[model samples]
Target: MKKIFLALLLGSPLLNFAQNKLSGVVTDSVNKPLKGVSVFLPDIHKSAVTDETGAYVLQNLPSGTVKIAFSFVGYDTDNRSIPINPGENVLDIQLQPSEFKMDEVVVSTVFNKLQSQNVMKVDHANVRQLQHKGAVTLIDGVATMPGVSQISTGTSIGKPVIRGLSGNRVLVYSQGVRLENQQFGDEHGLGLNDSGVESVEVIKGPASLLYGSDALGGVLYFNPEKFAPAQTVMADFGQKVFSNTSGSNTTLGLKTSTENLKFLVRGNYTTHSDYAVPDGDRVTNTRYNEQDFKTGIGFSNANYSGVLRYNFNALNLGIPENGISEQTHSKTPDYPRQRVYNHLLSLNNSVFLGNSKLDLDLGYIANTRSEFEETATPNLKMQLNTVNYDAKFHLPKFGRWESIVGIQGMHQSNTNKAEEFLIPDAATDDFGIFGTANYEWKSDVLQAGLRYDNRRISSEAHGIAGVEGSFKSMARSFDSFNASVGYKKNLGKPVTIRLNVASGFRAPNLAELASNGVHEGTNRYEIGDPDLKTEQNLQTDLNLEYKNDHFEFFVNGFYNFVNHYIYTAPTAAQIDDHDVLRYVQDDAALYGGEAGLHIHPHPLDWLHYETSFEMVNGKRKDGDYLPLIPANNWNNTLRAEFSLKNFTDGYASLNVSHTFGQPHVGAFETESGGYTLVNLGFGGNVKLGKAAFNVSLNGNNILGETYIAHLSRLKTDGIPNIGRNIILGVHFNL
Candidate 1:
């Protein structure tokens, strides 16, 4: 009896392991085997490619219900859920030809669902697409999206503006963790490198229920590049060059994977001289250089998966003061420059238990910034350190309902390392808990969530108590409850509508609550309001989409109402030879929308035409326009795709963009004139003997338009944007 019991226990392990196996074959509509098809399991971070026989296999998969995705170029993707028992399972997929954009699974949202199945509308774009558009920087690519813009200081420093909001209202995430890099100042840019990044997902509305504070506007989530397939090794190299800035970018990467372990590493270097204007003169002190490195390691078993990632970035950026003056193309930056460094580390883990799963993510970030004015020593320096954590438990599915409960928190500290201080030393702590659920019935879906958050901040006094630049020791606590609800319905086979209502809140930052010194970036003396109230907003969004064989159309509209909207205004006062500005609050409203359409003629399947328009308006209750509002813009593009004798995926495109004049100016602001620009692009993949490579050429502002953007920070200094730039890029697989 004892021997039988022991044998039963030991044999049970082998039986369960045998059941955790999945194999599949992929075929096209004509029953022809399809090679190079991607079979991925996102939950476990496992992927495989179909062989010439269209056969693929994955071993040691978690038991119970799991989701699988099968995808290929020029074909419709298949996403389905399957159940596994104590035996091998096989799933064969048949794909159909598709002319429209392929559907992708989004991870930024609460539930990992395909774009076509999500209750809320989310925009997704890959890095490769942005590169093809001739984007010189990461933010440049992001700004090209509808309803998005950038506040630019030069070609190298830019801050993303979503809809009509900027600064702390927007949240950024990378490597499944929140990015904390002292983003309270307008001079601060997104401290991220484009290399090693796979794609970006934009949530256009309030997302406080998913993120805690500082998400009153929206979220930008970046997905990292995936590891190589099981038992495979891969390497790649790429280079890009720019004419206007005399810039170059170089990148190299290597990756390898086994059945249960994966490792990858990447390095990038970029350098650029001062950017030139239409007059062919370079902007003084605008040169910059950067170095970045990223690495990751991942391991998985039948019931658990874990991944660890690290990134390091260093930058030296010259602060542009005077307009175009120098004609030299030197790579070294002049004085009055900035030095910044960022280090990020994150770990993500998932445990599958029965029919439920638990996910935990932890992250740490350290950021250091320094500014130089006249001497070799730094004039202003600060260091920020942050640690954050998140945990979620996915409840077992019941009928058509799925739910999740999660908790998130962060601890941060800031210290001054220079003699001059703009804000006092501070420490902040945050905590939040939330619950969300999703329900699906036929073609209708509903999603809702509620969350509660609390933040506590404490600061130490600095300088003389009664001095003009003095600060008093203080402590403050802010608390709020937020919620979101969204619904999606299919009106017909080719039409869909979605509506969402969400509320978000933001706790004032240390700079907004304690600043009492000169802001060199803005050339103004700023004072903070210690008694400021928390800013809260409620937003409503509506979307309508229509698609068929040869046409696609989409329109989105939103209205946002805020209580205690904060802004800075000049006062009838001056200090230290600079005008004085004080932070204030008032009730405000903003309304805007984006609409676009795509057409592919029936017989001319290789030809495509696209157009889009975006606009936004913001006003206070006292009938005054808000500052930094973007101008209305329209964009049109014509593109053609073909395959040459030795080249594949050959394409050419022409784009025209028009910006309308901004007559509605805020107090103490000037209006901007309208402008138009033209751009051209072409690219192709070439096969030479046994080697394959991709080549692209792009020309931006081909007409040399000499105009300033409405959101350009240099507009106050009468500096026009860059013009007549050409880009050449090449990539090779080794």
Candidate 2:
């Protein structure tokens, strides 16, 4: 035994010499550090976790060609193969976010299996994309995606509708957890930050297989950066000033990693006064401010990995309105509202089970909102808390098919209190089981999935005795099923084709189906219908894409059939003799298509120009056109980049877009004028030894025009749109 032990110790050096140490950092689209990222080798059976600084170090790595996999709980999983040389191997990796769970992929279950191009993976917006554009909200960054449209300002209050579906039918995931705010309200902000987002992905069709309820439209996913592996510390800071709103913003980020653990932390703060029209006239009290924070940590080894993360954000809004009495002046703060805070905490683990992969995630989310009105003295408050857990297994092999199975469960509770309960306290439990399978060849692929969801809800005052304290609790149950199949083929030429057919469904929100009261925030009376059934949607889409060296284009068309659609319909009866609108259910049909073309005429590296256009039209099955949908739109952009010696990288860009507004009848038959906006930006970067300093100047609505976008909700309160704005920003990296 002693001789065997000595021989093992002596031969360990040979094993160590056969392995290589690899270390590096990962960042977001904004170049901010990320943490709690998972890095592993499937063929070699080795893995490591990133530290808080978005850094990872894998020891005992075999040399020669090896396959490496990278994944974060909230983001997409990425794989690549590289040849390891002698001594040390250093590589820096940047990971993007994902919409579907990994278990949804067949390749995840089979080792040494090759993935087809048809594996509808999530797409990420990289640094090149964000640095090339200036946006006001998250919608501005993702609205251009295939099958995605914004019906509101397309800025601050925008929500993405997938394949003619919107509102509560869609689910939004941040860092791998659902955000439970007033998602049913159009004016509700998504409460996210573009500064910290590594990237975003939109899942186009039915996703009930993994997400359970409230995913009929699809999912919007955001992933932050992971920790670095190099025992080194990095910091970045920047400030931006907007010309239109005279608004200023700032962000600070930091990352660091040690031998065993890693950490990444970032914070952002922004404040803006009322913006002006292109005419330089103040747009009154349409001012808002926001704050956001995020942090993550991870620990990992060969067989097991664990991660933890935390996030918090808040939005404060002040809207302008014309007052009836002298005491309430035009700038007297007609609308003072606050979505005080949204908080999230998460923990995840992945354990290797022979050839199978076992993963689990547990999370908790808290959302709080409050409103104070000038017309009423009391303050209204609503709070929601949710607990979620998920577990899944990736099966090794099944003939020529790969498969996965998973279980998910969530518990939610909400409470609202005020002078009168507009929305009352409610409790709900949701559980689901799902599976997916995929088969593929070199250029042809086929995939299918199915999901079953069950929900139980309990609410007070439903079929109860009285309105006062005599309320009795009522319990109800709901179930929904989702199924989808997709086919794809890639010709050796420059064109690729994909066709998909899917069915999705959404149950009415607890508040929309059971609440009966008055909301003080918007001064509106709301009534619910208990007889409403689950809303169902059937969608079919075809996509043709062409790609080459200098030009790429895509054309996609879709048709949708919906049942029991929910909408805010006008009612002849008044609450206190004041005109109002109530929630109602009706059948509807929607059809539309979005297409884009890109051309780079100049072959020279110094100059390049790109142009694209998008158009959409939709009408209800009843022939009542849907309200708030935008008309045809198009944008043209031109840019030039110059490399000066070895020290400077300079670029200048200009953009112009036209938006047409067709007539739509809202609660009051409101009509908006069509408008056009132009934007211009110029910037350059200089390398200072190992550090860099970058500066940019941008102008929005350069014409200073006074046209309101089709999505502006300001028409409801008699406020005119703002004009052109300017911004100056500076960036530093080390």
Candidate 3:
């Protein structure tokens, strides 16, 4: 990593260029200046808000073709590609008025584009938007997206599931790098806090062509908060409280930026008591607390820009054992709990070379996980360290075509530090090279990409050989070639259609290949299969969308086929009084779709109605249903937006969600019953002269419904999910 950084530094001289300036005016369709319109350049993390005259200026910009976005409430967002020269550049933008929300630029994809312009459909949501919906946790907010669900142990422990796939099959990206935190275990959760995050983007189908192995299911990308605008200093404080869990989340942050330098820091603390059910009983040992710190520094000039970021997170998550046996409001966790520490550091750099650019990202992650059972010393502990690197080169445009080539790789190691072990000490390596291109003509757009990846894994033997709780030494290598193609066309002025096909693969993880011990979290003794082959899948997606002045509608469908799909099944045996399960492979298929619509009456623009339905089905070639598939869901909401005398952006909403009974079950799994839930939210921005603040009040499960989600790990134990939670939040900017 040092050598690579040094080489790039020495080559910077050749990439330098003259700085440019940009000044713009924004107006509405009626030729009236629109005050407070936001003008942003995502590539350089620079932004400006139009003044009373709708004028904005940005300085010290690189001389190249850059993408700029202009947005305001109740207006159609506009994205344009502007070519910068050596001196001053003047541009004017005219935005169209609409009742619909503004679309955001998606960063998860290779080429950053607005949702309406991308060939592939992606879901984008801001953290503030999710918070307004009364989400208790980051994962909870993510599960609200259509076609996404979670395998949750409690309110604090959640694993994302996309289209019936979870675990290592899905990849997560944070701070412009892949998050490595021992994700193979079912009880593991996303080790991230939403305090300093800006937004999230979801790619719902095979993304291996861009991310490589482990993207067979999908990708979840988190975008960190941007630096303060140039020549500005900003500070903010936010707090939220929950009733059911007696939980509180507090965050404080400060950021400052100069012409060519920027710095920011944020700290967050979260604590929750054992959650209560409808019967007013708390699930024993279901509490958790977290402490998180994030900081970043950035430097930019005319030709080069770089940002370095670091995050440290410490968590104590209590493992639920007895189901609804105790009632307490204590925040501290008891025995049989997990203590995890994560350290992540990343550096992202971009160099402009005339019309082309080079981008480099390097990351390092150290994760320590310990499980304590009945004693001060941990019963199981593991340390995982990973280093990742990615480099992408954007070539100059060739007429109506644009292209990029990239290389990516990772080196990882895992070691055991406690007496008992679930998996052997292992080392893994990965390498991949890919190239993708896009062609656009009139209202039609086409995109294609191909990639090749190689992964090697080696492990050291552990425990007594031939013993029931022993693991044998092993070495294995897997290789695959993947490809993806997508096309988008405008069927008419108000309609568009998109189709995409992609292939992806996932190499067997260490636990699946070498485990031979009891997994206390699941209360089962698991055995691994070293002969397991790579899991490969091909997926096809189709999407259609229609939008007009007062109404919008969309429908999306997908089908995926997998080869050598790996799963665990129970055997007619036992180990240490625990059921014995063995890993196995079979061919499988999954199909799913989502449909949604939104309407706003012509004169009653403040009144809005929305509804969506999502469904998925998975089965093996032999006709057995897949385990952990989410139940079909239908959600409806009625919302009102208004600007009161002393408040702006005020809104209220009522939502009703219904989940259908899941009758299709795996061989050893039981069916789940259906249920309905109602939720309410109310919030607004309060303006007090020159000072302003935001407040929100949201209630989830307002009906106090007692239910169990089909994907809950505690479902088999007859544990009901949390009920009747009310959340109150306040945020202030200073």
Between the candidate structures 1 and 3, which one is better when assessed by TM-score?
A: 3
- Tens-place lDDT per residue, model 3, 80-192, is 88899889999999999978889888899978888998999999999899999999889899999999999999898999999999999999999999999999988799999
Cα-based TM-score, every candidate: 0.97, 0.82, 0.98
Candidate 2: list runs displaced more than 4 Å: 1-57, 60-116, 119-123, 144-156, 323-335, 375-378, 397-400, 462-473, 518-524, 580-582, 646-649, 664-669, 688-691
| Model 1 root mean square deviation, Cα atoms | 4.7
The candidate with the higher lDDT, 1 or 3, is: 3
The list of candidate 1 runs beyond 4 A from truth reads 1-19
Better of 1 and 2 by lDDT: 1
Query: Candidate 2, TM-score vs. the true structure?
Result: 0.82
Alpha-carbon lDDT of model 1: 0.89
Residue by residue across 87-194, what tens digits does model 2's lDDT show? 689888876643222311222221233222544433345422554466656676676554566655312456776655678887888766677776766456677776
Best by TM-score: 3
- What local distance difference test score does each model get? 0.89, 0.65, 0.91
**Per-residue lDDT of candidate 1, residues 601-680 (tens digit):** 99999999999999999998888999888899999999999999889999999999999999887865789999999999
Candidate 2, residue 343: Cα displacement in angstroms equals: 0.9
Clashes of 2: 30
Task: Name the best candidate (by lDDT).
Answer: 3
Clash total of candidate 1: 0
Look at candidate 2 and tell me the lDDT of residue 350.
Answer: 56
lDDT of 3 at 410: 98
